[model samples]
Target: MSTPVLVINSGSSSLKYQVVDADDGGALAVGLVERIGGSGHGRLTHTVDGEKHRSDVAVPDHAAAMAAMADAFEQHGPDLAAAGLVAVGHRVVQGGARFGHSVRVDEAALEIIEELSALAPLHNPANAAGIRVAMDTFPDLPHVAVFDTAFHLTMPEVAHTYAIDRQVAADHRIRRYGFHGTSHAYVSRQAAELLGKPLEETNVIVLHLGNGASACAVRAGVSVDTSMGLTPLEGLVMGTRSGDIDPAVVFHLARTAGMDIDAIDDLLNKRSGVLGLSGSQDMRDLVDAVEAGDADAQLALEVYCYRVRKYVGSYLAVLGRVDAIVFTAGIGENADEVRELSLRGLESLGIEVDGEANRARSKEPRDIATAASRVRVLVIPTNEELEIARDAVRVTGS
Candidate 1:
C-alpha cells in the first residue's frame, strides 16, 4: 500500500514542496516556488523522476504560489488529483509551547499558529498564510502541521529552562525551543536502525550541520537535550549565525559601537558565523581556502569544529551512555574534513572516526566509527519531508 502526502515548507517568500510516500519515505515528486509577491515574476521548478520542468510566472501571494504549484502538477507528471495523496503536511518552524506534536489544521489551530507569529516573526505568518491558501486549494484533503520544535518538546524542564527572571520569562514565553526537530528525529531513528538496535534502547547524539546547525541528544527515542534555544540563533556556529555569544556583547556593541538592537540582531544572524569569520559561507569554498593556507578560513573551521566538539561532549554527559553519534544535513554528511576536525581529540570519549570510512563518500546511511570505538559514529542523510509525511498520516489517519 502506498501513502502519498504532500509536504509543504513555506518561507516568507518561497514555498518548497514534495509528494512523499509515508510507507517507504521516498519522494514521488518535488517542486519549489520562489520570489512570491516580489517585483519580478516568480519561478517554479518541478521535478518528476529526474525530469525537471521550470516556469517563470507571476505569483503575487501564497494563493498565487499555490495556484502555480497546481499548474505545474497539472502540466508535469503525477497529477495531484490522481496521485492518491492522503493528506497535506506543513512544516512549521516554531510551534511554541502549544503544539507539542503534529495537529490537524483547523480554525483554532490556525489562529494559534498566527498568534505565535510574534515569537517567529519571519516564519509563522508565512506558514499560516500557506496553510490558508493550501486549505482552499485542497479542500478535500486533511492538512497537518508538523512543527520543527515538536520533537524537542520532550526535553525536561532542567534541559529547556533558562536562568532568567521567572515573571518575565513566564510573561514572555521565553525558554529553549529547539529547531531542526524533524532532522534530529529522522536521523536518530535512522541511526538506531543502522546500528541494528531498537530505537527505545538506543542513545544517540545527532549533529545536523548545515547552514543552520544544531546538536540533539536523543535518549531512548526521546529528545533529552538540544543545542538550539528560543530561536535558531542560539546553537552551534553556522554559515551565517553567530552561535553561543555572550548576551552582554549586545550591550557592549550598543554602548561602544553605537549599534541598535536590530543592527546587532542582523549582525549575529546574517553577517556572522563562518561567513563573518572567513569572508565566505560555503563550506566547500572555505575548506579549499583552508587548504590554500588562508588564516581566516582556518580560524573559521577551528571555531566551527570547536563548537561542535563542545556540544558533543556535553550531550555525552547528558545521555550518560551513547550508542551512536550520528551526523546528518549537508555539511555533516558530505564534509569529511569537518567530521574529522570536529571529533579530532574525542578518542578518549569512545567517539573515534575511522579515517578511511570517514573519507569514503556515499548517499546511503553509513557508520564511520572504528571497530574499537565504544560509540558508533554514523552519517545519515536527513529526510524531513518523509518524517513530516509520516506524522501527517498518523495525525490525520489518512
Candidate 2:
C-alpha cells in the first residue's frame, strides 16, 4: 500500500486540508472548511475523478469542521476503510523560541506550542486548538508540527535583534520572528530553478503579498533577511494592518486623543493599512479608483509601491548581486500594475522589467526581465500548503 499524508492548515475560521501521496510528493485531494464560526456557511471542495465535490454544512468549531472534512474524503476519495493513515502535518503558527524546525507531536510539544500562544495571541491558540482536535479525531495517526518561524531561524543576531534595550527583550522574547517560511523557502528554490543555478549559489528577493505582505532576502537558498519582525504587524503595509509606523504614534493617540491601547491596537490591526488610506484593501479597487481620478487611492498605491521598491533596493544591497527578483502571492501574482510600478526606474541597479513581458504573465514560471537588465524578474504563485504537507511527510516518519 502506498503511504499517504494529510496536510491540515487551520485558521481562526478556516481549515485547509489535503491528501498527498508522500512517495511522489503529489497532492491527491485538496479542500477547505471555511466560515467555522460565521454565518457565511461551511463548505468543502474535494478533487476526485477530474471533478470536485463541494457541499455546505454547519461547522461551529474547528473539530466539527475537521470531522466533516474527513467524512467528505472517505465518501469521495481512495479507501479509508482499511487504509492505514500515516501522520497528519499541522501548520502551527508559533513554535516560539523553543522549536526551530518541524517536530513530531507529543503531549509536551502541545504544551509548549500552547505556552507560546501569548506571543502570537491571534494565531497560536487557534492553531493549537485545531491540533488538539485533530489528535483526538485521528488518535492512531502520528502528527507533525511545522512552524512558520522555523525557516527564518537562520537570521543572525544583528538582523533579528531590535534596537530596544537588551534586558526588556530577553524578558519578553521580543525579537524578529519572520513568518511565511514555507512560501519564502519554496519561492527561493523556484527562483533558483528558473535561473538553472545552484540553490546554494544565488541570491533573490521574494515579495509575498497576500492580505499580509512581506519581503524576504534569500541568500544561497537560506533566508538572510526579512521585513516582518517580532510579529506579522511589522514590515510592508498589508490589507488591514498598518505596516511601518512611528513608535510614538501609539502613545500620542492614547495621551492626546484619549484613545486606549485596545482601541488603538484594533484600529491599526483591523481598520488601517490600505483600507485606512484608501477605504479599501483590494488592489483592483485601488487601481480602479486611481483610474477614475481618486487622489486618496492613488496616494495609497503610491505609498505601497514606493515601500516595496525601497525594500527591493535595500535587499539588493544586502545580497550584493541578486540573480533574480521574484514576486508571489495574490497581489504579487495578479497585480501587474504593482509589480511594474515597483520595479520601474530600477535600471540603475540592473533591475529593469520588460514592460511587454511584465504584462504577459501566464501559466508556468517565465522571466519578465528586460533584455538589457542583469537580474531576472519573475512571477510565481506560492503554495505554502504543499510545503507544509511535504514537511509533515518527513516529520511523521512516513
Candidate 3:
C-alpha cells in the first residue's frame, strides 16, 4: 500500500477529513465531525472501505474533535499508524498573495497563516485550529498547508485588482483573492483532459456552483480572471451571500435604516442571495418550488441563472476562444435545470447544451453540449480532498 495523506478541511463548526493514497489518488478512509462546540451532541461519522461507523460524541472543540477522530480510526480498520501516513494536509482558505503554492508547515508558515486570518475571519482561524490539533496528534508526521487561493494567484492585475486607489488598496492588502482555487485548478485540468487537449493549451471556464458559487476564466490552464473578488461575498449569487451587489447598498441601509456595519455585513453575507430572493436557499427546494409555480422561487431561479450566464459570457469574452465550460461542485454537477438555464440562449456564443446529454445522471465526467456546439459544456465532479492530498505529497516529496 502507498503512503496515505490525511487531508483536513476544518470549518467554523465542523471538521472533514480523508485518508487518501498518495500513489494512486484513492480514498482509504473518509469522515466528518459536525456540530463542534455546540450544546447538543456532536456527531462523528467515519467510513472505511465502504463500511460506515458513527458516534454521537460530545466534541466541545477542535481538540476534542481530533481526539475523537483518532478514536474512530482506532475503532475502525486501517488505522493511521498502519496506513503509513506521510503527512497531514490542511485546506487553508485564504493564503493571500504571499502563498502562491503549497508549503511545508513550519513555525513561520503557521505565523503567517495566523496573520493572514484577517483576510478570512470565518475560515482561517478554524483552519489554524485544525492544524495545531493535527500537529499535536500526529507529531511525527509532516504537515502541509494547501491554500484555496494559491491557484488564482496567477491572475493578472487587471482581473484581480479592484478599482479603488492603488495606495489605499495596497496598504490594506485589499485585492481580489479568489476562493475555490483548488477546485478550479482541479476541475479545469480535468476538463482539458476530458477534451483530449494538453492542459497548457486548454482554455476553459469553470463554474463551481455549490451553495457558494464562483466562476473562473482559466486560459491555458492559468486563472486569468475569476468572479470572486476580495472575498467570497463578491462573487456569484450563493446560498446566503449577496454576490455582486452595489457597494452603496450597505451605505444606503446604514443611512436610511440606521443599520450598523455588522448588521449590514450579516445581511449581505448570511441572509442574502437565493435565500433573500426566495424563501429558501437550497437549489433543490427552489427547483421544486419553481415547478410548483412559486413566483418567488421562479424569480430566484431566473436571477441566479442569469448571474451565472453573465459571468460565463464575461469569461468567454476574456478567453476569446474557449475549449470547454466545466461545471463542478454540488449544484453545478447535480442540478440539471440550473445548468440548462445558465447556458440557455448562449448558442450565438458557441455554447449549446444538449437536453438529453444534460439530463444524464452520472458521476463520471461527460460532455453535455451538442456535437455542433463549438464549445463543450461538461460536468466534472470536484475532488478537493484528493487535490490537497496530492499537493501534500508533492510538497513533502513522499
Candidate 4:
C-alpha cells in the first residue's frame, strides 16, 4: 500500500523535486537542480534519510537536469527504477479555466498547458518544457499535472469576474485566477480536521504567507474568494511584489518616469513590496531591522501586516460565520511576530492569538487562539508536495 509519487516544480532555470509517499504522507527523497542552462556550473543537491549529497556539474538544459536527477537517485539513495513510483506529478502554475483539477498528462494536455503560457509567461513554458523532458525520461510512468490555480476554480463567477470592459476582459481572459491554491486547499482541509468538523460544514480562512502570499476564504471547503487576482502579483504584500496596487500607477509611471511595460513589470514584481519600502525582502531581515529601530523596516512591516489584517477582516465578512483562521507556509508558520502583528487588533472581531502559544516553537499544527476567542486561530504547516503527489495518484488511479 506504499504509493510513492515524484512531484516536480520546474522553474525557469531550476528544478525542485520530491519523492513523496502518498499513503504515509512523507517525503522519501528531496532534491534540487539549480542554474540549468546558465553559463557557469550548475549544482545538484539531493537528500535522503536525512543525509545530504551535493554535486556541481554542467546542466545545460532540462534534459541534462533530468539525467542529473536520475544519476543522483541512483548514486545516493532511493533508486528510482526500484522505488515503485506510481506517477510523476508536476506543479503547473497556471491551468487557466480549461483545467479545473489535476489531469493525466498526454500530448493533447501538454499542448493545452503550453498554449496557456500567455497567462503565466514566466512559469508555464518552463513547466511544459520540464513535462516534455520528464515524459521522455520516464515514458512508462503516468505523468500528472496538478495546477496551483485549479483549486480556486471553484470561485463563483461574481468573485472571479473583472468589472472591466467586458468584451476586452473576456478576450484577454482577464479574470481572477488565484495562486497558492495547492497550499490553500491543503491547509484548509487541515484546518477543518483540526476543528473536528466535516470539511463540507467548515468555513475557514487560509492565509498562505511565504515570499508570495495570498488569503483564501474557503466556505464549505471550496474557495469562495481569494486575495490574489488574475496573477500572483496581486493580493497581500509579498517579498518583492507590490500587491493590490492601483492600476493607474502604471499609466502614471509610463507618462512621468518614461518607464516601459517590461520595466514597470520588473519594478512591481522585483523591486517593490517590503524591498521597495525598506532595503530588504526577507521577513527575518525586516524583523531584525524593525527590532533595531530602522524606521523604513518598521513601516514595511506595518504595510505587510496591515494588508494581511485587511484581508482577514474582509474574509470574515465574506464567510459570515467562520470556524477558524489557519496560517501556513514559511512566514506564516515560523514568523511568530508576523502572525501576531497580522492578527493584531482583531480581538473585537473574535480573532485573538494567545501570546505564549503564538510564540511557541513547534513544527506540529496547534491552536494559537485564546481560550475565550470565538474563532480558533491555527498554525498549520503546508505540505504542497504531498498534496500534489496525492492528487497525482488519484488522477492516474495509481
Candidate 5:
C-alpha cells in the first residue's frame, strides 16, 4: 500500500478533507465536516472504498471536527496507521507574499500564517485552527501548508501592484494577493495536457466560477495576472460579493448615507453580487427563473456572464497569444447557459463555441470550441486536493 497524504481545506465554519495517494492522485477516502460552531446540528460524513458513513453530532469547534474525522477513519476502514500516512497538507487560503511555496509546518511557519489572518479574515483563522488540530492529532507525521496564493507568487510585480501610494501600500501590505491559485494551477496544467501542448509553452485563461469566483491569466505555466485583489472579494461577481466596484462607493455610503465602514463592508461582501441583483445566488435557480421570464434573474445572469466575458477579453490582451480559455468550478463547468452567454461575442477574438459541445454535459475535460476557432475553449474540472497532496509529497520528500 502506498502512503497517502491527507489534504484538509478548512473554512470558517466547515472542513473538507481527502486522503489521496500521492503516487497516482487517487483518493483513498474523502469527507467533509460542516457547521462547526454554527447555529444548527453539525455533521461529519466520510466515504471510503465506495462506502459512505455519516454522523450528525455537535461539533463545537475545529478540534472536535478533527477528532470526528480521525474517528471516522478508525471506524470506517484504512486506518491511518495502516495507510502509511506520510504527511498532512493544509490549504491555507492567504499566504500573502511571505510564503511563495508550500513549506513544512513549524512554529515560525504557523506564526506567519496567523499573521496573514488579517488578509483573509474569514479563512486564515479557520485554516490555522485546522493546522493546529491536525498537528496535535498527528504530532509525529509531517504537516505541510499548501497555500492557495503560492501558485500566483510567480505573478509579475507590475500585475500585482495596485495603483496607490507606495509607502502606505507597503506599510499595510495592501496589494493584489489573488486567491484560487491552486485551482487555477491545476486546471491550467490539465488544459495544456488536453491540448497536447507542453505546459511551459501554453498560455491559458482560467475562470473558476463557483460561489466565489476568480479569473487567472497563466502564460507559459506562470501566473501573469489574476482577478482577486488584496482579498477574495475583488474578483468576479460572486454569490454575495460585489466584485470590481468603485472605491468611492465606500466613502459615499459612509458620508452621504450615514453608513459606517463595517456596514458598507457587510453590504458589499454579504449583501451584493448576484444575490443582490436577483435575490438568489445559485445559478441553477437563476436559470430556472430566467426561463420563467423573471426579469431580475434575467438581468443578473446577463451581468454575471458579461463580467466574465470582460475578464476573458482583458486576459486575452494580457496573454497576447492564448492557446485556450478554460473554465472550472461549479458555474463554469456546469452552467451551459452561463458559458454560452459569456462567450457569445468573442468570435472576433478567434474564440467560437460549438453550441452542441457547450451544451453537452460531462465531468471530464473536453473542448467546447469549434474546430475552426483559433483558440480552444475547454471545461476542466479542478482537483485542488490532488494538487495539495502532490505539493505535500514534494515538500515532505516522502
Candidate 6:
C-alpha cells in the first residue's frame, strides 16, 4: 500500500473527492463540487486548504463534474502528480448482496452495479457512471469499489429479513442493506478507541446525520443492527427523503393520488422529509424558523430528534451494555441544537451530553458527555473517504 489513492464519493449530481497518501493514509487534499444540476446557473466550488476555488462549469452530468473537480485540483493546492495518486477508490452507494467487501472494479462488477440500479434508482446508475468515467480518466490506475452496504452485511437474517413472502424477498433481494457503513464502521472503532477497550468488547450506537441520516448499533465492531433498511430512505428523516413510512402509504398514494411507481419514488426520494415537513431543505433555515416560532419547523426538528432518540434508546437495549453513543456526519457533527435535543432526558440510559461541551465546535473528535454520565456521547467527525482509501489499500495491497 505504498502508492497513493484518490477516493471519489459520487452522488446523483455531485462528486466529492479526496487524495490520500497510500503509505500513511493521510488525506493530502479534499474537495466537493455540489449543486451540479440546480438551475440554468450552476457552480462548482472546490475548497482546498484555507481557500476556495470555484468555477461556473456547465455540469450537465456527473462526468462533467468529475472533470471540473480535476481542474480544481490542478489549479488549487496539492498537485495530483506530486500527491502520487497511483490508485483510485470509489464510494459506491449500493453494491448489493453480490459484494460484501471492497473489490477491484471489473466488467462483471460494473454490470452487477448497473443491475442494482433498480434497487437504488437515484444512486447506483450515477455511481456506475462515475466509475466508468474514472476508469476512462485513469485507465492505468487500479480502481476499487468500497460499498456503502458492505459493512452492514454482518446483520443477521433476523435483522435484515423483512416480514414478507420468502419468494418475493428472494426475487427482489428485498433485505436490509444499510447505507453509511463507512461512517458507522469508522465511528464505532473511534468510539472504542476513546473508551480504551477492544472493539469486540465494546457496545456503541452511531448516528450519522447529514443530507441523509441513519443510526447503527455496533457490537464488537460488527453492525449487529442499524436503522437504514434496504435503502437510505428507510432510516432517520433527511433533507429530502422520507424515513420509515407506512407500507400502506405506497399503495395508498398509487391508488388515491393517481401516482405511478416512478412518481411515488420521486416524491419519497426528492420531495419528502424535512423539506416536505417544513418548507426548506436546509436545516439552518428550519432552525431559524423554529426560533422565530414557526410551529411546522419546530415540529420537523422535534420529529427528527425524536426519531434519533428512539433509535439510541433502542440500540442501548439491543447492546445490553452501552459504551458510547457517537454523533457524526454533517448535521450530527455540526448542529449543536440537534445533538443537545437528541440526547436529552437519556440520563437513565447512561447517555448524557454536556450542554457547554456540545456547543463547542471542534474539528477533532471530542466527547461531549457530562462527567457524571455513565455512557459517553461523542462527536466524532466521519472520514469516509479516508476509510475507503485504507480499505482500498488493504484489499489491493497497494
Provide the lDDT at 377 for model 5. Answer: 95
TM-score per candidate, chains pooled:
0.99, 0.94, 0.98, 0.99, 0.97, 0.93
State, as a TM-score between 0 and 1, how close model 6 is to the true structure. Answer: 0.93
Per-residue lDDT, model 5, residue 298, is 96
- Clash pairs, model 4 backbone: none
lDDT at 100, model 5: 88
Cα lDDT of model 4 by residue, 1-398, tens digit: 89999999998999999999999998999999999999998999999999999999789998899999989999997988899999999999999999999999999999999999999999999999999999999999999999999999999998999889999998999999999888999999999888899999999999999999999999998999999888899989999999999999999999999999999999999999989999999999999999999999999999999999999999999999998989999999999999999999998999889999999999999999999999999999999999999999999898
Q: Over 4 Å off in model 5, which ranges?
A: none
RMSD of each: 0.7, 2.0, 1.0, 0.7, 1.2, 2.3
How accurate locally is residue 247 in candidate 3, as Cα lDDT from 0 to 100?
Answer: 97
Q: In angstroms, give how far residue 262 of model 4 lies from its true place.
A: 0.7
The models' CA-based lDDT, in order, is 0.95, 0.86, 0.93, 0.95, 0.93, 0.87
Per-residue C-alpha lDDT of model 2 across residues 1-398, encoded as one tens digit per residue: 46677788888988988776666656777788888888767887777656788899789999889888888877887555455557788888777679889999889999998899888887888888899999998888888899998888888888899999999999999999899988999899888998999999989999998889999998999888999888888889889899989989999999999999899999989999899999998999999999999999999999899989999999998889899999999999988899999988899889888888888867667889888889889898787866776777777657
Off by over 4 Å in 3: none
TM-score of candidate 3 versus the correct structure, residues matched by position:
0.98
Q: lDDT of model 6 at residue 144?
A: 92
**Position 361, candidate 6: lDDT:** 76
Of the pair 1 and 5, which is ahead by lDDT?
1
For model 1, what is the alpha-carbon lDDT of residue 348?
A: 88
Q: Judged by lDDT against the true structure, how good is candidate 6? A: 0.87
State the lDDT of candidate 3 residue by residue for 1-398, as single tens digits.
Answer: 58689999988899999998877889988999999999999999999989999999999999999998999999996767777888999999999999999999998999899999999998999999899999999999999999999999999988888899999999999999999999999899899989999998999999999999999999988999988888899879999999998999988999999999999999999999999999899999999999999999999999999999999998889999999999999999999999999999999988899999999899999999999999999999999988899999889998
- State the lDDT of candidate 5 residue by residue for 1-398, as single tens digits: 57599999888889999999988889999999999998778998899999989889678899988988888989997788888888999999999999989999999999999999988888899999999999999999999999989889898999999999999999999988898988998999999999999999999999999999999999998999999999888978899999999999998899999999889989999999999999998999999999999999999999999999999999999999999999999999999998999989989999999999999999999999999999999999988999999899899899
Query: In model 2, where do residues sit more than 4 Å from their true spots?
Result: 1-3, 22-25, 38-52, 78-85
Best-fitting candidate, scored by lDDT:
1
Q: Write the per-residue lDDT of candidate 1 for residues 177-242, one digit (tens) a residue.
A: 999999999889889899999999999999999999999999999999999999999989999999
Please list all clashing residue pairs in model 1, or write none if there are none.
none
- Residue 189 accuracy (lDDT) in model 3: 88
| Whole-model lDDT, model 4 | 0.95
Off by over 4 Å in 1: none
